[model samples]
Target: MSEPTGVLTLRLAGPLQSWGAASRFARRATERAPTKSGVLGLLAAAQGRDRSADLSDLAALRFAVRLDQPGTRVRDFQTAHHADTGKSMPVSERFYLSDAVFVAAVEGDRDLIGILHAAVRSPVYLPFLGRRSCPPSRPVDLRAHPSGLWKALEAEPWQASTWVQRSRARERRVELEVIADLSAGDGPGDAVRDQPLSFDPRHRRYGLRSVHSRAVTVANPLSAPRRAFVPTQHDPMGLLED
Candidate 1:
């Protein structure tokens, strides 16, 4: 089938989201910033796929995130207790947990929309904001542009405004205020469309509160296919090159 296109707006918020990175050792886990792989994995689960698929169609899709109330990173230690042997051992471990909100915007082919809709309704996989496995606070949909999306996001009656900041490494900080005001009637979609999906620091705080914006790309898994029983490296290249 020809490639499908659409946009996905996911709102992520919870007490803790665990995106592991550089974790090795038993009972050891490390939390890293959310990545395209982890987010896609969650989407695939909604589709009932336990394993990753070739979703290359999502590659060209634009990705962006707006973090609301960027939370601090915390690490905890774990120790082992032997019940039968009555022995105690100290074990060191590291991981990350944070309470923050995420707004993700994805734009792509129409087929992608159908998949997302189905995934939301009867998700083969559970949906999560970060790692909290929390159901989306609102329905996910495809809109014309960021303004349309902002409208939908604000429409939620329970929406609250807040200030947020994100650390770009451990040094610099970007600040902004975000407010829930979709009623202002942002112009037609075309004018704001194709804005290269960037986080606006000026609009950082939602109302008087601030939030963090973490943008990521969603890769398409179906763009390239390998020949039957061929060595992986020997597979032909550029079949999808336009």
Candidate 2:
């Protein structure tokens, strides 16, 4: 008998975020969206799990993210010196998403999902969007959704900021992109290497996971308002008295 399952949704919004699955050397790069490993790591941190802790159970949960407000990508450079040697290290370039918002969801056994929900509300360790430097602007927990992953994402109201929503007020509906784990019997998807194998720093590892992408349109809450009619002032000349 299979265990009953549920989905937990997280609101990942921040002033700056960096989710880099393939970052290396002095050039740390962030993916356009959050990675599965990054989101799972967040839950693990909420539970106060150590880096070396087994992640099989958490890794088994299916993952997905909705790009609510795709923020601007910006870069900065930093130079640091070795503490022990007092020698300057190489200049490093780091990238971040400014003012990005994402709705990340994971589906798993109901019992496990419940525990994660509780952990998120009062996490053992404070949760960050993707890195420690990028703290969430709002509470991360949006509660558990009874529906499935894709449906939950579609049903969730627009999470964009007031200004962002207002910026697109002219539109009646907005299309948001969703990226989710590919399941059996589904069409082919692009492969990514962000699946968590181990968070162990000594020997960190990852596996390939297939992900599918789609878009959902939701009503714009801040749709454009009707323009009020204004009586035109009579021209002083009155068109030269016609």
Q: Give me the candidate number with maximum lDDT.
A: 2
- Model 1 lDDT tens row, 15-50: 656555334575445333444444555666677653
Q: Residue 196 in model 1: shift from native, Å? A: 22
Cα lDDT for residue 102, candidate 1: 54
- As for candidate 2, its clashing pairs are none
Residue-level lDDT of model 2, residues 75-172, one tens digit each, is: 98989999999999999999999999999999999999999999999999999978898999999999898758888888888899999999999998
**TM-score for every candidate vs. truth?**
0.49, 0.91
Best candidate, TM-score-wise?
2
* lDDT of the candidates, in the order given: 0.45, 0.93
> What CA root-mean-square deviation does each model show from the true structure?
23.3, 2.9
